[model samples]
Target: MSRSRIVIVGAGFAGYRAARTLSRRFRGAAEIVLINPNDYFLYLPLLPEVSAGVLEPRRVSVSLAGTLRGVRLVLGEVDGVDLAARKLSYVDPEGASGELRYDRLVLTVGSVNKLLPIPGVAEHAHGFRGMPEALYLRDHITRQIAMAAGGEDPAESDARCTFVVVGAGYTGTEVAAHGKLFTDSLARQHRRAGSGLRGDRLPRWMLLDIAPRVLPELDERLSRTAHRVLTKRGVEVRTGTSVKEATNEGVLLDDGEFVPTHSLIWCVGVRPDPLVEETGLPSDKGRLCVDEYLQVPGHPEVYACGDAAAVPDLTHPGKYTPMTGQHAVRQGKTVAQNVAASYGYGERRPYKHNDLGFTVDLGGLQAAANPFGVPLSGPLANAVMRAYHLAALPGNRVRVASDWLLDAVLPRQAVQLGLVRAWSVPLESSSPETAHAPAWSGHGYGPDGNAAEKPSQG
Candidate 1:
């Protein structure tokens, strides 16, 4: 008899974990097919380091085809799912379309940058969710600082020196923190190199959020620690504040302050991929609804997890799990086990795991963490953060660690390759699960000739 086919959509934390676990467990018992836009699984947490030039882009990306054994890799962006027919369709990177039939389907489609209706933000601000954005930022910042150093007008130099980051979440906070350090190094290098635009003020970084504090969702101590570290690093943390409007010239804060800047890094958050809603399935707040076992109701063969699924939180009654790395990783294993159990591999289990703790790397030896509720700061926290990342990263530990070691001993590479352009990483990327096509076309294409969603990276 022919083996059953299992199709897993996505390659982020949940999708990658599920693929790895399922590949190990099923082996020849089934055909494991992993569909992702890219052939690599991005280690998203380390993305901040990529943007800050602490780590190279490839350092955080583990090879999907290389590391995932016994899995057939399909490179494409899923555009539609026909649940009733048990078939899905997608367009490859070259505008070629294909379809696949699955005995079991797993939707770990991750998420895309959350967009707000704020005026001009869609056109002006850049998001920090993927490799393209990170790469763009690294070069953009370097070029800005370099250009500012040789600028003739002080106001233009000041504008170029100022960077406004919206949202004080982990991504935003880390960007502002590490980014401050990265620019500081560049400024020093610029001065030493001699001859250029002198008298330019130091780079000014502003981290704004509507919340009361940085990392507000984490422990109070963690929040306080991050806040203190940021303020000390000369990052202007404007809590209880937000952007009223964003323009190419600058951002207008609700507090009546106009910050002249050439850069806006949007790290507000992410919403489930729009693919979940396109299915016309029952959903909760844009995520596909799934039971504790990660199976879609009335669709036993279909499973959903990660940021794309609204999995009930057994620990908290009547509530759904928050989209976090901790929950997604666990849910991936649970989904695999439950899928296997459905085929009589083992007993099914519910998804349950409390957050082990939270760690925020504040660049250099500064960090804030409350692992298992033990609050730690300074070098100790940084050590914990680094160790956790090393262990969590699926591959390339030595390379990442070496980067860290060399960064401490050597100056960061302050050059941009001009690889990713603005058109490549538009703020309104179509779907997080889809690898970006040069030109968005085929099915799921917006009337404007792009994917209905936007392109994203990690």
Candidate 2:
């Protein structure tokens, strides 16, 4: 008898957890293959720390091969899935094409940056989705500060020192919070090195959002806490505001104010990967529709989770689970058990989970958290936030902790590596796991060559 082949696609939080669970359960009884563009699983929650120079890039990226003991790793980006034939086609990193036939398929392909129709945004704004973007933003921030210190033109120096961040969600809030600190450190270092820059002309960070407050989706207390911390740190918190246009000169606010800036970090939100819609599967608002068991309606051999699947929320009637890492992690385990049960190894169960709570790291010993519905703030909240991250991280706990310790005792090393260029990480094509193709291609754009608006997820 031949062994059954189980294929998992896109090793994000959901896919990575699913593969890990299944490998431990099946051991070597079945063939398990994991497909992803990168070899490491990015710990997305801490990506802001990477951009802020609080943590090394490797600290958040866990190795897929080194961790998944019994699973086969396929380095490729899946582009086509033939549900009728149970086969999927993918392109590898070196521009080679490949295909896989599977007895069971798990689709956990995550999301990409949510692009808007704003002019010059796709060209001028930097995204915060993947490692490349994080690295690029760090270098860009450093370069802007370094250049500002030496520039002769006061107007140009001020523009270079001004940073604009759009969106006030988890990613945006963290980015602005950490970014202000990062730029401040760089400016201080420049001054210490005897640069001619003045103390009064500190880097200006403006966080803009159309929403009424930061972390709007989270608890109101978290929002208030974050807003308080940001304002205290000299970050301009611009609520009920948005950008009308972006240009090389700066961004034009919706209120008709042109803010001179060279840095625009776009973190509005994320939509599901284009591959999800390309599957031609039944979808709910661009997410693959699946039952509470995470099984496709007509395809029992196929399952989906993470940001890719609209898994019906059993805990909340008539609603689907939100696209969050907490839900994705639990759903991955549930899907793995259900998949194993399909092979008569165990009994299947429906997915059901209640959100424990959320935490927001607001840079520099300031944090907001509501664990188990108890709201917390300040240094205590910061400790809890770090504890939560360390507990949740799948690997690299020691290294990450060590980095935190080192960052506390030593000054951050802020030097631009000039690794990821600006043109390489276009907003329209910002999925970290996908190959960098032409930005306004047939991927996420509409007939007008602009980003078609879609509902956002985690």
Candidate 3:
């Protein structure tokens, strides 16, 4: 009999782990293929640090080929899958199309940004998902502050200096916190240079969420810690409020107040990749539905995990697992084992993992973390948070750690690398290039493409 071919689509938490585990379990027995746009797996949790100049972009990306030894790496985005034929079609970086025949398939394409119906949000609000968005934001923030420093019109200066971040999740909170400090440092530099810019008034940031508190999904204690830290850092936290509309000038809140600002960041949440809809599989809330064993309900040859799948939470009856990296990574391991079982290597088992805890980096020495449900805050939380990320990252730990060390010893290098355009990293795109594209696209380009829903990344 021919050797079984296994294809995993994605290089995020779940897909990467699946590839790693399967390669080890099967060794030379089975052929494994991993498909993704980038050559590396992104350590998404530390993306805010990248934007804040606390770390380099390379620190967050682990080389796929260098790390996954036994798996064949396919550098492209899977466009369509013929389940009956067991064939996967994807377009390469150079626009060439290729097909792969598989005995087993794993769908872990992950999630995309969730865009609300708010006006102008699609045009003006930016997201922080991948490195491209992070780099673009870093440049955009610096540009805004520099423009505000020397602008002749007071109103224009205020608008340029004002920033609004919607949502108070871990990503939103960290972005706002780190972003606040970055802007301040930029403004101070302009004043020191005597750039004829008003340095008396500092940049203003507002963090908004419809929920009553920040980190609504996290423990109440962690939320309170984050709230206190943000409030102390001069971030305007508006709970129970949301944007009714967003214009280039600013956003109109549900509370009948219009907040004027040139920057509006949308960190609302994420929905499963739209590609899941094309799979012809049963789905729940846009996520592919899977049995407890991480297999498609009717197709034992197919598996789905990560943000793309709706997996049952055995720990909480009547609930599906929340879309998070923690669960996705574990599910990847379980799916690999189950796939091996289909080849008569082992027995398949259900996917079940309890929440360990969460870490929220609030920039500087401030952080909110709960490891093993033990709440911690301040520098202690910061230490734990860094440790958690260093331990969780599959690769590039040394580089990331070095960056952190240098950040402590040296001043932040805040020069903008004008690479990512506003269109390239739109609110959402089904195209895979958007997911793996570079941060900078030549000169004078930004990621201002069509809009889609927001994404929730771990």
Candidate 4:
């Protein structure tokens, strides 16, 4: 008999872990295949450090071929799934199409940027989700500072020096925190190089969120700590405020105040990949609905985990698990075990896990963390945050650590690589895995000439 083929879609936090676990447990008993657009699995949490020039982009990217010894890696973006036929179709990077048939399938395709209906946002703002965005942002920041130094108009220089960040969640807060520091360092370098830019004309960073506090999903203490650290670092934290409209020149706040800025970063949130809904399976707010065992209710041969599946939170009755890296990592392992159990290897188990805690790196030696219910702040929290990331990274620990040490002592090299351009990473694009050209023309009007309906935040 032919060996059973198990196919996993996506190579994110959940998919990567599942592939690793299955490869080790099944050995040669079953065929394990991973389909992903990229050759490496991106470590998302430290992405801000990459944009801030603290860590090289390659340091956060781990090679899949080198790590997954026995798994077959397919380079493609899955576009269609035929559940009854047990086959899926995908298009490779070069636009070639292919198909795969599997005995068992796992969906962990992760998520895409969450876009709101605010006018001009899709055209004026860029998102920070994957490697391309990070790389583009780093160069953009450097170029802005460089341009501001040579500009003749004070108004233009001020706008170029200002950065407006939307959403104050984990990604948004970190981006704003690290961004302020990055721009500040750039300003200092320009000034030291005999540029006419003065010390008082430092970059202005504003963080806006409609929520009452930063990190609203986290504990109150953690929120307070993060707010304090951001304000201390000269970040304008505008709680209960958000953008009403965006333009090439600036953004208009909901309160009717217009703020001039050349950069508008959209770090709002994410929703499940569009592939989930395209499956036409039972779904919970765009996420495929799965049982406690991580299996589709009517499809025993199919399993789902991570951001793509709405798995029940047994710890919290009547609720689904939050879309977080912490839960995604654990669910990946549980789904792998259950998949093996379906083959009569062991007993299947329900996914049950308690909140371990949360950490927010506030740039430099300031951070906030709640580890095992113990609240920490300042350098202690920073240490905990760094240690946690180091321990969690599957590869390149030494290189990441070395980057941190070097950043601590030396001035960051600020040079624009000009690799990623403005039109490549539009905010309305559904997936970060592939770079889609801007779908809107002139302003923020989408293809239908109407703002896309906002999806529910998980």
**Per-prediction TM-score:** 0.94, 0.94, 0.94, 0.95
Residue-level lDDT tens digits of model 4 in 1-458 = 36999999999999999999999989879999999999999999999999999899999999999999899999999999999999999999888999999999999999989989999998788888889889888988998899888887888889889999999999999999999999999999998887757556779999999999999999999999999989988999999999999877789999999999889999999988989999999999889999999999999999999998999999998999999999999999999999999888788999999999989988999999999999999999999999999999999999999999999999999898877666666776666856655447654547743435321110
**For residues 36-70, what per-residue lDDT tens digits would candidate 2 score against the true structure?**
99999999999999999999999999999999999
Worst 10 residues of 1 by lDDT: 449-458
Candidate 1 lDDT over residue span 1-458, tens digit each: 36999999998899889988888888878999999988899888888889889998889999998899999999999999998899999988887999999999999998899999998888788888778788888988988888888878888888888998999988898999999999988988898888365564568999999998888888889889899998988999999999998877888999898888888889999998999999998998899998888999999999999999999998898999989988899898899888888778889999988888989989999999888989999999999999999999999999999999999999988887767655566788865423244455543455554546533211
What tens digits encode model 3's per-residue C-alpha lDDT throughout 1-458?
36889999999999999999999998978899999988899888888988888888888989999999899999988889898999989988888999999899999999888877777777678787777788878878887777777779988888888889998998899999999988888888888878656647778999999999999999999999999998998999999999998776678999999988878888998888888999888899999999999999878889999999999999998899999999999999999999999888789999989999999999999999999999999999999999989998888888888988888888777576656656556665564225444334433334553224322110
Q: Between the candidate structures 2 and 3, which one is better when assessed by TM-score?
A: 2
Q: Could you tally the backbone clashes for each prediction?
A: 13, 0, 23, 0
Angstrom error at residue 33, model 1: 0.4
Candidate RMSDs in Å, in order, are: 4.2, 5.3, 4.3, 4.7
Candidate 4 lDDT for residue 136: 84
Ranking by TM-score: 4, 2, 1, 3
Task: Give the lDDT of residue 427 in candidate 4.
Answer: 71
The C-alpha lDDT values of all candidates are 0.87, 0.90, 0.86, 0.90
On a 0 to 1 TM-score scale, where does candidate 1 land against the true structure? 0.94
- Alpha carbon deviation, residue 129, candidate 2 (Å): 0.9
